[model samples]
Target: MKKILKYTLASLIAISLANCTSDFEDINTDPNGISNESLTQMNNHIGGSFTPMFLNVFNVTPAWNFQLQQNLLGDVYSGYMTPPTPFAGNVNNMTYSLVDGWNGFPWSDAYGSVMPFALDIKNAVALGGDASGEKFVHLANIIRVTAMHRVSDIYGPIRYTKFDDFETTGEYDSQSEAYQAFFTELGTAIDELKAFEDDAQFAPFDMSSLGGDIAMWRKFANSLRLRLAMRVVKVDPALASAEGEKSLSSDAGFLEATDMYINTGFAHPLTVISGSWGDVRMGAEMESILEGFDDGRKEVYFNPAEDPALAGAYKGIRMGIEIEAKGQYGAHSSIGSVVDSETMQWMSAAEVYFLRAEAALRGWSNAGTAQEHYENGVRASFGQHGVSGVDAYLADNVSTPNDFVDALNATNDIAYPSDVTIAYNTSGTNEEQLEQIITQKWIAMFPDGQEAWSEFRRTGYPRIFPVVVNNSGGTIDTDVQIRRINFVENEVNTNGDNVAIAVGYLNGPDNGGTRLWWDIDGSNF
Candidate 1:
């Protein structure tokens, strides 16, 4: 894979302006420092743009970038992991202080690395006048939605639909509007790619687990549609059901047997953050749930604690607690061999099964019964990790998440938030059944904390622990938890006028406490 060049703030602004301009020649002039004429040598004009889109979806290189882009926010908020280091003298994102400097990466990385390349593919294909090449545009759209939806989830309103329009270059889409656009784009991609299912033109540039098989790309698009469809179920149930059923009934199928992984040509970032730097460790919630369930995958996800007091135990640290130094909890479990490779998982077949399970719970058309899909989700996850005893694990109904015990500090420990059991709750309430499905989904989609955090906000399942110390100055509530991240400083500085208007689209003030459009604070039923 070609190295993705790092862009400074000025170049990123230049690229954004360049994208909005109407001149075709100006749009083709690569702002990424690659000459379009140079890229035409081997169809690299279109193919070359794909690598960055895949890499930036969940950045793998420059561990610090990934730390800021995901690990600091979603990974901590979702209860998957937390940093041992008390950044800024113990007042940081983990404590809800909402650092603007660190929070900007998710927005910047997506805009700089993902959106431009996708737009470039669309323009390059159109300028080439080869109708067959439209397939590349569709593929780029699928990847774009995959990346952009996470951005919209992070910050409620984003510059999406009107991004290419010169007049509305800095306009923002409300989360609802952005999601509607996602469904439309994903639907179009799934439909158009049907013609190119057997086309191998994408093989040379393919950096994903799909291996450039257009059929598999179609399946990924379909599965992604289901994900976005489920996301809006609370805010727009009718639209959710419509899109959900469409994906369920699509002939393109879903990610049933295989997972979607991007083979980033660089080392996985977690190896550096958790292993080399000792900056991140397992979270308290992970310890409670995995130990309570006697989950076999725990060993696969993290190594035993290195602290002499808890040696050989799978210990983890509680989030948002005061600590003078990293050494206090630095010896807690670090990440294991799961991220030892170059590939970063984007979506998994196990995740699709859980999505279908939720669709079934909601009575959507064509989805299998909740129990079957739920069990399949669990089994699929076990298979993905090559763990054994899945059948017994699935049948154990009495097991519940254990109470969290902070090894170094008893003050930070807490009881497990819920009594959600392992077995499928065949005779439970809709809320209970929903929790079962989502909790399993949460476990299945480990390490990909961006989606996990989004689902937690949407459904309130898996019962993540609240912060031990909220430093939000009352902007964020202790019990309510953080709903969404504030808009980045870069947007406010560069597109202040449009961002001022976008904040009005949010349900409340532009802070972490504001619930997004789909994060309705009500019953799932």
Candidate 2:
């Protein structure tokens, strides 16, 4: 990684631009006499790249609990969608946050960090450098995609090609274009990695330091390809389906074990319990999910809601009522339980397996029997997570659904510690097996991204609940949940015309309640 040169260049720019603008100088200069060593410069840059990956961990906590967590719990986000909004609002609450319809406040750790360093890494590869060069390009590409998705998914447009240029203001590409670019970027990187084809090894880069090793980098790249493909399911099925299939068919590896995942080992302050984000309780939906499936992972996902103050007066928030009145409606529901302790979930291989299962089920190229992929996904999840014995799981009612309808319904069912997977129960129909597969997949990714929500939306397999008790939103959801977030406030100001076009086409009349391109139909697209 050639870093000192970039800083020197920036400093030179700062010296020249000081007369024109103090702000430019501020961005380009430090004045602090920090060590000017090349290794130090590289470390500074790498440390900065950590945000895309770290912030992603935060984005999903709210989403996992908000989008996937509560939906599985009982179909409510903190209830920003409902009449009397929950204290923690939906899509609106995330600072400068939007799902897919608007603009966002843009920051550029990835631009300054991941992008330049990656360019260096790519250049090194081109020069026939060692495994470290290949590793850097592969991991940097994965990191780049991660950051791009977060920005593009939220704001609907971003600067991809000219992103890192300090001199240029940068052009905003449409979300469709950005998604396509990501597919190209990651796919090309994958090919380059294979082209490098190095057997030599070196000291592994810290997941905290960079991303990981060459093999892990390949797995991470493939896994990300799966995620990005899934993202466009509503917008471009043909493309999304093809991307999904390629990962499944290709020997590109995925994170299947806990150890194999991009484990950050992030310090406690960043954990769900104590991080700046606050201890994310196991959202009520997640709790319900665990209870419904009779899944044992609840123990791993959360601790019992502790009102441990022996002198308690209900000071602690009730488990599932974070967003008060709004949760009464469908799609306006419970979230993951907030635990007393802090926790951090980087990534998991089980996630990759489940993602693969989805690709296979959709009948992608080189995809295997859905049944086999689904089962392997289940076993791999169980095996990686440390749950044991299929015997106890088979006996459970909710977790082991007897038929397809029963299994789909089981997703909304509160999972219990005793609930286990018993796919061996051949007595059940094939669809029933899919229910078990998706339901478990939902459970596996509890603390990570919104796969469960996407799976539920796409498959509609694990039947969940409607907001039957109270009509908070008052909209009356007939079939299933709403898709996509309303774009953030800034879009109207910064990119008004383009934002309007997307909202008009994508959101329809009721913008917030609208669906994205992939979520064509709720009954499992």
Candidate 3:
């Protein structure tokens, strides 16, 4: 990207971090209390960098940024949501036009807010003695990996594993290289963090739902490792299985029973985007599966349809369709109050269970039976949402994904392609079992569309609706759909050479048609 813009953004982030200085007014006679400068002087700068990174990843402010970075693109693409507004005369992302203006937010936000902060933390902690500050370094590494992996998932290649070197900072790592770095970083963090299991240095800087519990952070890190390992199972099964078994057997265990979340002081952006502004509503796939299973979590996930024509029913819009204005489908089911709450889910325990379920299907050691893990995943999700009747739902073997209907366009409708049910079929083939695991995992991971989108690209479970319009100018196939986002315009303008090299890493032209390194095209099973 532009060096000047990057430098300017870093300066702004430093100023923001300065404002987060801790209040120091204990027995110290200096009543003026510790100034921001003193906080940095006292080695508190390392922890200070974390607040901005955590808060900005799933950006808590200027709700429109979140709309562009995640809600509009991943949310729609993953079949979790669709927008009502006909942005730019309905030829936007919902219609597969790939809006250049909006597509840059995820990249810009990562490099501008998250990566810079993470770098500052690593640098600050590294300045201290290696043995003394190892814990802080590990913590920073964990946070860095957590934030950057999402960026790598968005656009195939990203500035990672080389961000610290000025000469190579602007260069990109291919998605596979980035994933390897993530594994390395997580491994380092997990190994070093175990040495400081009793340490509370992170507690003061902790703003996440983990609440400064270093052990819980370890659990989160291991769970993240498992999630990433599973992503590569199809592309590199041996490595995937090895990493998966390591995570499952780690002393710092997976995110079992409780998931990871961040309690940003502000209301979730979805509350504002989907509830207040009505810019987004439920996607048709969500409506089909949730309504089909008669899942009790539907009430927790969405409000009743507001359109008078479909009164009291849960309804959603198709991805790409002609719309004159937001008022057209704005009255459809609004996002439920669950997302509008105080915290944003980072990873769900339900997802961890499903990941283990897949590992079990692959016959990985310590993963338990697939059926047991699958049932636990569903039950865990129900408990997470405070929905009752899990036993009844798990026992019902007949419910299948209902056929999706577009009330506005008949051609947009499609039949339910799979007969996978909520109950586990012990005698089912590996492919059948895998689909069942992923489909529910898809449901359990609702509203966190980025992960869901990545898994969908990897496995093709819980079949999502194809866009009704092909606005890609023939770059992206209507059936295959958009695989990866093209590198943003900012990179083209300033880092043109590096962006071109990054395109070389892609399997096809630098467009939505190109698949990422881990996104194999054939059956995962």
Candidate 4:
């Protein structure tokens, strides 16, 4: 047996010497110049890098506030990934009312690019196998859950069961069922990643640092689970606590909210025109909220409006109110555009803290104090956007912490308190606490678009008034509002049956105003 193994090794080495390069020449193909190692390995690495890059593009942070949606300032932010401001301007799709048609395509992107590549990395590692397999699955599942959570949030009960088979027909799956998949996947991922003992498993996968790459990735997975538990607090409170408890239960465990983020220190290049935030501006509604509170982040986030230093003149649109016809509001943005390439963000520490804060307030017992987790989220949000002296802000009036409403109005209040603390009154009902949870969830969303939209749809807390001028060729019913987007044009022509089945579940003729399954909460009364 020993002799056989030695000869087998010799055979491979001899082959390498005899004809390392294939003789076949199809002028287009390179035999000698491109090594087999390069062909195989580079393809996988390039594919891996490409997935994160493309994801950085679509994670737009949708909000009813100026910090989020203006063409210029908002675009430059890590909070949201927005489209190029069009010539006449706006997301070019005619179906732009409910969402930019692009944000609506996670199904194709996740299954096709994001999720599959992540799985590919794992497969490659397993076949011949690299130690990186663990991180590959961990990170992939983080992103996969991120995209899937949005799919379930946006469209309601999306088609999860027909995942690989959506090729035949895009069958619509139930929201509860889809969430169960997220539950199983997240739980398994956290367990698998936490169990991985090697530090080198994610060296190449590190977007941040080298030493603890896999550890950070493990935290990201756990943090993502924390976030999912919060998102469905409305749909399933029992499950929410169960998941959170599971994390605390893991002894050999992961990073908690206070230390759970991977800060993506993306720097700006020489050119703004091609940069990430260059074309996007802080949306008026978002800007107004920050400015109204004298929220320090306003300046860090937005350049003073080109013509006016007065906050009211900047991207100061009202939230959730119907805009008058297009003529009523200025389509032109007052702040400068977003420098696109300048920012990159990832699942953050503050986000996890905020999730835990909400969970704690609802009495989901856990590792950290609810109040501490809440303040950590606020502090992280402030620091990320360059807001200074945040520690001082929280310390100014330490006895009484500012609740979510206080923070929301901090920039807008006439009598804005100079000294406010991050405190919660347990006397506030669970209903009231839930509102506070979501409202800050709105503010902490400076750089994430999909989560903001998802939170808003589920909680409807930071409500936006209707669009004054929408030409989406669909009705904006006062009762139902946005239901779902009309199926993408190509899909209707190609996967008509699945689209038809989804429409049937919708009850409301299947357009943007249709209410999805989980979004069917609360009495509009």
Candidate 1 residue runs with Cα over 4 Å from true position: 1-42
Candidate with maximal lDDT: 1
TM-score per candidate, in order? 0.93, 0.64, 0.93, 0.69
- What C-alpha lDDT, on a 0 to 100 scale, does residue 258 get in candidate 4? 34
Candidate 1 clashes between residue pairs 3 or more apart in a chain or in different chains: none
TM-score of 3: 0.93
In candidate 3, what are the lDDT values of residues 200-297, reduced to their tens digit?
76777788878777788889999999999999998899889888898989899888877789888888999999877889998999999999999899
Report, for every candidate in turn, its global Cα lDDT versus the true structure: 0.88, 0.47, 0.84, 0.49
Residue-wise C-alpha lDDT for candidate 1, range 1-525, written one tens digit per residue: 001122333355456435533344543465344344433432565777888898898887799999999999999999999888999999999999999999999998898899887877776666555567789999999999999999999999998898765456577898889999999999999999999988888999999999999999999999999999999999899999999999999999999899999888888999999989999999999999999999999999999998888859999888899888998889999998889888899999999999999999999999989999999989999999999999999999999999998887889989997999999988999999999999999999988998999999999988999988999999999999999999989778767777888999998999999999999988997
The residue pairs that clash in candidate 3, if any, are none
Question: What's the TM for model 4?
Answer: 0.69
Evaluation by TM-score, superior candidate among 1 and 2:
1
What candidate 4 gets wrong by more than 4 Å, as runs, is 1-108, 122-126, 129-135, 157-161, 165-172, 208-212, 252-280, 308-314, 318-342, 389-423, 470-474, 478-484, 504-508, 523-525
